[model samples]
Target: MRASTPAYTMSRPMSESVAAIVNDDIISTYDLAQRMRLLIATTGIQPTQENLPEFQQQALLSLIDEHLELQELKRVEKDQKFPIILNDQEVRDEITDMASNNKMTADQLLASLKSQGIAEDTLFQQIRASRSWEHWISGRYGSRLRIGEDQIQATKARLVAAASKPQYDVSEVFIDAGRAGGMDAANKGAAQLVAQLQQGAPFAAVARQFSSSSTAAAGGDAGWISPGEMPPQVDTALEQLRPGQLSQPIPVKDGVYIIYLRDKRAGAGQTLVSLKQAAIALPADAPAADVEAARTKLIAVRSQIKDCATLEATVRNTPGVIAGDLGEAETSDLLPEFAEAAKTLQPGQLSQPIRTKVGLHVLAVCGKRAAGAAQIDHDQIENRLKGQQLSMISRRALRDLHSTATIEQR
Candidate 1:
């Protein structure tokens, strides 16, 4: 037989100091504040007065989810003889790992956290909650998990392809313009979020608070993605970044997206290039006169262009024209349309006006280079696939738990 759940209660008229009530647990303003501190200490995102309210709001939602996780663990363990507890060494190691990420020693991290009035107990408790949730999942479903040879081989092939091409580990802050509001309201909200993000607010924290996507729960991490997987706008944005770059807010059909390029693969089978480009904006609905004007400008300059340096200087004299000195980049990273046209250009040769999502671009080849076959690692690929599978399984289990649980927020 199952233990009885606590009775539901009305939310008290909320104050700025009060966070939320989770079943019988009172997640107070103090808890929220401490959690925010923990978030910064672990993730290295500094807090600000401007982004504080939204950060707290996001923290509160996480607390609510944590509560759900805890509640489910408790219900499942009612028949257990002992409460769940994590090893102290594991907790310490986690803290050490987090400190290393922030370029601090474990003692320094502890001192810094203490200086900010945050306690080690807070992190310890969080670890325990997460571990308990993991335990619950393992007990319920771990027995069913198996990694077959076919899955490993498929993952290996994908990784080889990734190493051959370009891939990114990206984190996003997505605003669901479709349901949150119309595009006008969406863009405004997205712009506000982007501003806050630029002002030192952590991308993950903001995503958990504000994003409507499922990935928001994990701080809007979009994991490893190939080129075509992203929306057209996002894919375009990705092309313009290196690892650790933060992109401006991009409006797509459904929502506004802001991304941090956490990482990318760089190795063999890579074709790198440097190019100079002259471009004119041909808006999707541009008048014929404007199109012809840009066309005339591109053609007139085509013969005069010599090296990339000459084209860049000359494009300055032409009105409504912009030139690019795209320093060495992977050929795969180039805009798809530009990459094909660029492939045909010899050193010191110019391309005809190439149609891109942005506009018409005429390119000059500065230089190009390519690396040999990729150095692939089948073991790492297998591990990544396993991790991905486990993550999906964990999410599915949590969704099941949430669907059956009784939750109300203030």
Candidate 2:
């Protein structure tokens, strides 16, 4: 006979006994409590017993969804005979990068997390889940993507255009009203900071001591950020100042900020590429043979296309095929294979089939423009596309899995 499944337990103090079960995975009351504590601490939101139940339910559901997705990922991989593994060193490196971005040492970050009641092991589990999901995606869908030369060339040209614009390097000392106690206190703090700067105190030294932002540890340095990256008040203030000049207290929503113009430069436009693609979707219950057949057909199409216009026309009448225009995307935005292909193509060239999450794609290089010619990076385009695709696949996968799952909510 098969051995019974293991039990799940938690160590935190909790008023409830159990929360919910995601398939065989149990979400405990203590697990919810720890998550609530971390949420409250990081966001500076007050937690109450009244709100705790709802928070616990929501958090439990989110964790359940994650577990379910992971199960589906594993199932898909097993059927495809794809290896899905998470490297511990990669997880550690990602954690290290997060800490560095926050201007905190790893030890300091761990201490902060502990103070917020977040367990290190919980974080590790989350990281493992994330890495596993990525590996599963690559294993299942990696061969479907083909980025082409025209796509890369278009991206490079866009980058060159973007480089022609103006940009500023700014530093700031932020005193949030909530942290300062009130608007009046925040204003006073900003004024005091201004006085220190005027009195010849080192800006970085004073920022290290008085700034309330995470950037405080980095001497309030924001580091070569574009105007669009900053709040309007800060951006406006910086715009009014010359290089090496400081601004008076600039009031903004939630805070008062003292701004310093570290340096300014003519924006260096980087290379960008744009591609038009046709994608075919596969149903959740589709057989492995059927999926492979579709992949082969798309690959065949890629080999025959000579340019973007021809590729676009070729997919015009195909059912379930989607045409996507990734306009002026950065090198970092396109996949590795796509970016490499983009570097060699002229305008109107067609790329080989590129595989992504949705299905097989045949790319067409629509146009190539120099960077800095325009703001090409649309806010969150890549993220939005990825999220939409993942959501679609996840919904289909979950539906299939749930049909056979024995789920209980408590």
Candidate 3:
């Protein structure tokens, strides 16, 4: 069956409060309002008339960009006539995933849409378009991209190093910053609770009884997180704590935090075997000699790296380098240049220097396993690869679409 028109258009005039036009499609003010509400709720931003206008304008521009992308995707689909398509079950599954990410059940999310004056069918239609676009893009571009065994090995090696580092399972108590008297009361209460914890009071019990965050119900558990994943102040406190220690009250931009280190575990799992590497870029207007000098330095750095460990250590020590353990890069996670370099290395080996738009890279091979190494599932790998590729392509496509779109605000 053909997908239905957006819900707002079905019962209302298409011309009413038209925000922008993308080809034949109209982005109405009603659509912008619903999107604004969703963005505000997700970002935890307090809504006000002052900010609402800005939000509405931004949302309308974003919608136009998305429409342009869908139009391009449709053009591709028509040209290729690819047999791959998202069935109704797949569409429903996508909706379920969206709901889960938002911490709501599918029914609850649908009800929330109703509260925002957005019909459930409208959202379903949007989901259909999104899924179809994904399908078309993957079918068109999947084969041209190559991710190899060496790339996965390098990623795995980095993950191993990361696992060797210390980690914490933390719990937090949050108090909303926007509420009147909220910050002061939460700060004082958290300070007292921290003192009580220092005096050996039960942390989880205190958290369950008093925290304002939804995680309070779960004893304020934030789950396992890396230092960079947390706010800087909170990260600093966690840095000083050993496992099973509790931190003093810390103020984040929007809340008060009292954290407890529940446990520590060594990273030795498939999940920890992922790594990401991006070639460092020189300034846009850099002198040719300076760019060449940087490239030569990167080559020298790559030449000394014998494995992922050395590569990671070198990047860590280098002033201008950023590297990460992506926990098992599939072919899709790698840039084309990196993937090509990865294809040449064995485990415990490093590749020759390769140039990309960013700069020069030396991809070091960390480890390799046959398709089912360490009990990693093939289907899981394929899905992860697909998701990563889709994200990269989508972001690029959206940027290009935005560049050409006409946008105005009232």
Candidate 4:
């Protein structure tokens, strides 16, 4: 069946307001403002009056793509006859977690945002876009993503041969020099993204919002890269950077690049781990009693962890929790609870109750083993490669949207 005209129409004015008319939905001016405030709050970017306008310009770029992603997702869902929706409670939980991380309660967070004239739904939608895109990518690309045993063995063998040649942890934010308006537009976009990064908007967030590359799906993570994996110019920039330093916009033949150096590692391989875990999620919109009940159950389970020995069975006792093998992972692989848990736990240990926007998480560390320069996990490598491919697919999808849609900025 052909996709129906979207439930929304391009010509109709949104009651909330519109900054741009996407294919059938609107990017409200309010979205841009709230996102700017959220960026400032999350990234520790102070919105000095002088830099605020600069931030706004880049925020719009991010939102434009967000609209495109949602629109495409809608079409994909309809044509494929599957629901493409992000849970509202999950969205609330993300906001709640963000507030907690900043040492504020969700209500206090909302109040603070309102004081700054930011809309609550704007932040909610941003989180929704992020979560939904991740789901779409993983679901859409799970089957075709490739990493054969021979491929892994080859990569591992190559690493073994290299001996001490270091792998650099890298992330990127890209601007297409090949855009229709050409280098001038690309450079301008790159400059705006760089300024936002300097102002404290995260590189990943900025990249996801602005990058023309496929890595935007994973927030521009290029992952652990070998010496020859990148072009000479990008590699050269990598050599000069210490971890946490982001590069200036470097010119490539067809791309403008901003690279973030994450780290460099040797033996025990950045202290990575592989995990199998489960969680029982309480509704983010639930009453206090329900949330506390879930938390209490989580804490009880956490206390019972003698070791990773029986974590799988114990985690599944909760109604909504299901155990899944997460394969091999780095500390950077997960968000707060699991990531922190992976970092601190022994090989068989279980982490304490880590509250997330989604639910109370009890993580089990299935294995924590050293990864030498030559060692690689098949499942993990497959996931990483798949992520890269998904990003590319998403990029192509958005490009199609740009070519076909009408976007009018007011």
Which of 2 and 4 is the better model by TM-score? 4
lDDT of each: 0.69, 0.62, 0.60, 0.69
Shift of residue 117 alpha carbon in model 3, Å = 1.8
lDDT of 1 by residue, 1-410 (tens): 22222132223335645457766777877677778877655544556676565456556666776787877677656768555434566666777875687699988877777787777666665766666666666655655667786776555444444444667789987776643447776677677677766777778867755676556657889787766656889988998999988898898987888889998765456655678888898877777787778888888877677777788788888888888787767678888987886666645668888866568888887755444433334455555555556656776666676676665555
**Candidate 3 C-alpha lDDT tens digits along 174-249:** 6544321367755765665566567665555455444545455456776765555568898788878888777788
Model 4 RMSD vs true structure? 18.3
Model 4, global lDDT:
0.69
In model 2, where do residues sit more than 4 Å from their true spots? 1-16, 42-54, 73-88, 146-391, 402-404
TM-score ranking, best first? 4, 1, 3, 2
lDDT of 2 by residue, 5-107 (tens): 2132234563666667877888777766665555444434334454454345435644665577667766765787654545555666667865787799766
Model 3: how far residue 42 lies from native, Å:
6.7
- Superposed model 1: Cα runs more than 4 Å off: 1-18, 40-49, 80-83, 87-90, 100-107, 135-143, 158-225, 229-233, 242-244, 249-258, 262-374
